[model samples]
Structure formats: C-alpha cells, structure tokens
Target: MKNHIVTAFRLTIVMLAVVGIYLLIVYGGSKILPTKGNAEIITQNGQKFYANIGQEFKSEKYFHGRPSSVNYNAAGSGGSNKGPSNQEYLEIVQKRIDTLKMEHPGMENTKVPVELVTASGSGLDPDISEEGALYQVKKIAEVRHLSEEKLKELIKNQAEKPFLGILGPSKVNVLKLNIALDQLK
Candidate 1:
C-alpha cells in the first residue's frame, strides 16, 4: 500500500510539472512572437483581435493575404484543412488562378507560385514566395502608380533569407509589402 501511494504521488508530481511547463511554454511563446491582428485593417469598423494572427482579410489597394479560418463565427484561428489532392482544393486553386489572371492578365501561369493559391496549413501564411510577390508586382505597381522595377526591388528586399546560409525557401511578408506599397506614394 505504501509503495502504491508513493508511485501515485510521483505520477501526480510528474503530471503537474508537465502541465506547468506546457502553460509556461505556451504563454511565453505567445508573448515572444509577432502576431497579426485586425489592426492591419481587414474591416471597415476597425475592429481588432489581440494576438489573432492571420484571421482577417483586407482590400486590393493593399496586397491581400492568404485565406484564414477562425471559428468562422467566434473567430478562432484555423486553416482550410484540405489536403493537396482534394478535388475541392483543386477547384479553389483554379478559382484563385482565374482571379489572379483577372487582376494581372500578363502574369504567366508558370510565374505564379503554388503558395499564392493553395491555403496554407494555418490559412494564415503571412508570407508568400518571392515569385508570388513578383507575379503581383505589375498590378500593384499600376494600382499604386509606382514603377514596376521599383516594386520588384522592394519585393526582393522584403524577402526573408532562408537561414544563415541555407534552409527554407525565401519568403516575402505580404503585410509588409502592402504597407510599403501604401507608403510608396
């Protein structure tokens, strides 16, 4: 009986430690990261969600971001949850392609990256590939009345490096690019 009691006590202690550590990590990480909120200007009312990154949509004058999902009604962070081979996924991709073509008629299908259309795991991928940025450059330039070459330069500079030397592919923060676009004039 004593042995069993000791074992139970040890297990309880371990479980408590795990819970405490998990909360610590979650709270600490949340505070440390830069999360997007409605402050980025998704709605006309200027409603803001604290630490709810990638949960809103904005306008064309500003570059748009990837699709995101929250509780849909309550606004919890989520993604499309569709796999690459899903037919629904395929249809959405096609729709996005058509839309992009409509927006920038000159951007060849080959130039547009897959990341631009497909929903990311979080549906909140704040960054797109440099190619995606370039694909939209002409349209953004025309809209902002800025030079295409200058827009390209800005996009290139905004791309984040993979690592110190090499790792992940280069990515451009859509939010940052749109902010710069607004500031360009």
Candidate 2:
C-alpha cells in the first residue's frame, strides 16, 4: 500500500537523522578530551607505552593492579563474566587473597581492597582505587628500602581525585605510579 511505503520512508528518515546527530555529538565531545579520544602514548627510557591501557606489574616493589580477565590484552577487553556467587570465581579470588597475604605479611588484619582482586569491566583498567595503592605501601617500602611515609606521600601525589569533585571514586594510575616509584632514590 502507498500509506505503508510513506510510513516506512518517514521512519527511515527519522532514524538516519537520529544516528547522524548522535555521531556528531560523539565526535564533538571527543574533541574536548585529551588526545582527542586517541590513546595517550607515553615514552620513557626509549620505551613507548600506552598510558591509558593497563600494564602488568608483578614486582613487590611496585603497586599491583586489578586482575585481568583477558590477561591485559587490549584486543580482548572484557570481564570474567563470572559473578561473585560462582564457586570458581570465588576460589580464584580466594587464591589471590592468599597470595597477597603471603606477599604482604603485615596486612593480615587490614582489609584487602576489593578492586585489587577483581577485574574491571574492561579488564584493561590502568587505575586503581586510592585505598588499593595505600594498602601496598608497606610492602613496597620494605622491598624498595624507602620510607613508608615517603611512599605514602608519593601515592598521595599520584592520586587523581574524583571528577567534578563527586562524580567517581578517586584513583591512582598504576603505570604512572610505578614510573614515579622507579624514579625515586
């Protein structure tokens, strides 16, 4: 019917308009952000690294980040897809907690920060909660032979506060923190 054809044409035009407007908004928004939505590349010691993506840090002298479901592979960014109630997932987390206990002897009484044991939704998060960084201060200080107070100060300095003062939790970018730690004497 002619009416049906006209209706389909009108709907198609509306859908196209909506999609175009959305894309324009996204492009415009990206222009205001740092690097214009491109990955932030960082250079150190003749090595190039993407500052926005998570990197593995297993040394006791450096802060650790959240576990990666995709093994920190940016090409496969995703969570483990297992809920906390899942026995297998719980066991994995327990193993991590046990490992942390072994690595940091004095932290038996202190609560381990949850973010340290769980993977981010993207599984490539570069930042950790401020509490998570503080939790590892003593261990890092012992290994690095730096004063705990000084290391705490470094964590404080590296912390990125919640956006607009209340939008999200404060976090510390592990890569940046570790780089600064290495530079410390």
- In order, what is each prediction's RMSD in angstroms? 4.6, 1.3
Compose the digit string of candidate 2's lDDT tens values, residues 1-185.
Answer: 99999999999999999999999999998887657889988799999988899999977878999999999999979998999899999999999998887888899999999988889899999999989999999999999889999999999999988766897889999999999999998
Best by lDDT: 2
Worst 10 residues of 1 by lDDT: 36-45
Error of 1 at 58 (Å): 5.1
Clashes of each: 2, 0
- Residue 152 displacement in candidate 1 (angstroms): 0.9
What are the per-residue Cα lDDT tens digits for candidate 1 across 83-163?
Answer: 779998788888888887887867755556777676676555677788877877777777777888998888887778875
* Cα deviation of 116, candidate 2, in Å: 0.6
By TM-score, who's the top model here?
2
Clashing pairs in 2: none
**How far off is residue 95 in model 1, in Å?**
1.6
